[model samples]
Target: MHIGKAIRMERIFNRDTERAIIVPLDHGTTVGPIAGLIDMRETLSHIAEGGANAVLMHKGLVPCGHRRSGPDIGLIVHLSASTTLSPFPNAKTLTGTVEDAIKLGADAVSVHVNIGDETERDMLRDLGRTASRAADWGMPVLAMVYARGPKIKDEYDPAVVAHCARVGMELGADVVKVPYTGDPETFARVTEGVCVPVVIAGGPKLDSVAGLLTMVRDSLAAGGRGLSIGRNIFQAARPYQLVRALRGIVHEGWSVEQALEGLEG
Candidate 1:
């Protein structure tokens, strides 16, 4: 790895702990105009001020004029996409390259891979190629690996989830964002098998803040490296407060109840 890339990776890993608080704004690429994310600029500002360590977005969101106000949050340019208009949602194609990400001043680059989907093989190939390029450039690659396909009867199955995590590590991903398997014990096994950091994805918006906090706590207990939450935070009644509550759980190790109370106060 180049000295510069190594330093950037170190920064993303968090100086205080191995965990990270990543606010993902790349949803617009897939779902298009998600309710709370209609204004990318406002969302990015809230995330940065709320003490998130990093923010992941497409290149357009980070263009100089758009993100003018915010503390220096680590930036990870999402390099893959499958727009809502796409005929096949699972068939994600590369929209940007590591070189482009570097030119955009990205601290790292991210790609998504649907492990059990029909397009799995092609996506895995993309992951390998991207990882190789990132490695050569010394840039870290965050792989979003989710299980979905005829072969995947249950995404929450411990064995299947663990396999997904391991596949990301095997393919050279520096960090793997995966869905939590509903319990810490199962997730523990998943994290144990992977050498790289494993972070939990906050899937579709949760029913309530309490529910989201509980999931965050469970993931941390299961040895996850913090979170890569999107809708759950941004769509909340108080996005800034929600992030503070999540930060309490992830960084301070506060219990779900305590985190909620802190937010309410």
Candidate 2:
């Protein structure tokens, strides 16, 4: 790896733990200014204070969320986007480029590829193209791969999730994010198949923090590397407190019970 890419990776992935806790703030482009995202600067300050490794967002929003005083966090510019209002919502289009991310002072760039979606071919092509460009510039590419198609049965199936993770590796992603398979045993298979780091997406906001922490515990036990959670972290009653709880789990190996203590405190 080039020194440039290594330095960038150090910014995004913790230098000590070598794992990342990333919060995606790019939802506005898809779902329209949801809660916890209304005040970009405030939200970003809280995330940085909570010790998150990085925050992912669109290129345009970078300046809006920049922090002047809080603890520093890495910036990852999302390269693809697709609005929920679109007729083909799953069909993500490249909205930014490696050069764009670089110019924006991004530490890394990410791409979304719905593996089994109807537009799988196009998404795959996009991933490959982005990876090639990132390599040329020595930028790290994180791939958010999911199995979402009309023919898919269970998206949570370990076999299917593993396949999605592998696709990201095969196409040159430095890190891949996928939905957890619900248990440590089943989810273990997911990390086994992929050479690159695997991070779990916080699917939907769980009813309780304990439920969410338990999921994080299981994924870590199964060899997963941190999380790329959005709603569950930022939408919580206390977003910074929630991130501290998550940091305890991701970096400290705390039990679910132990992690939930911060929420109570």
- Compared with the true structure, model 1 gives a TM-score of 0.95
* Every candidate's lDDT: 0.86, 0.92
lDDT of 2 by residue, 1-265 (tens): 8888899999988788888899999999999999999999999988889889999999999999877786889999999999999999999999999999999999999999987788999999999999999999999999999999997899999899999999999999999999999999999999999888899999877888888888888898899988999998889889988899899988887777887787789
Error of 1 at 142 (Å): 0.3
C-alpha TM-score for every candidate? 0.95, 0.98
Predicted structure 2, TM vs. truth = 0.98
Name the regions of candidate 2 deviating beyond 4 angstroms.
none
Judge candidate 1 at residue 224 and give its lDDT: 90
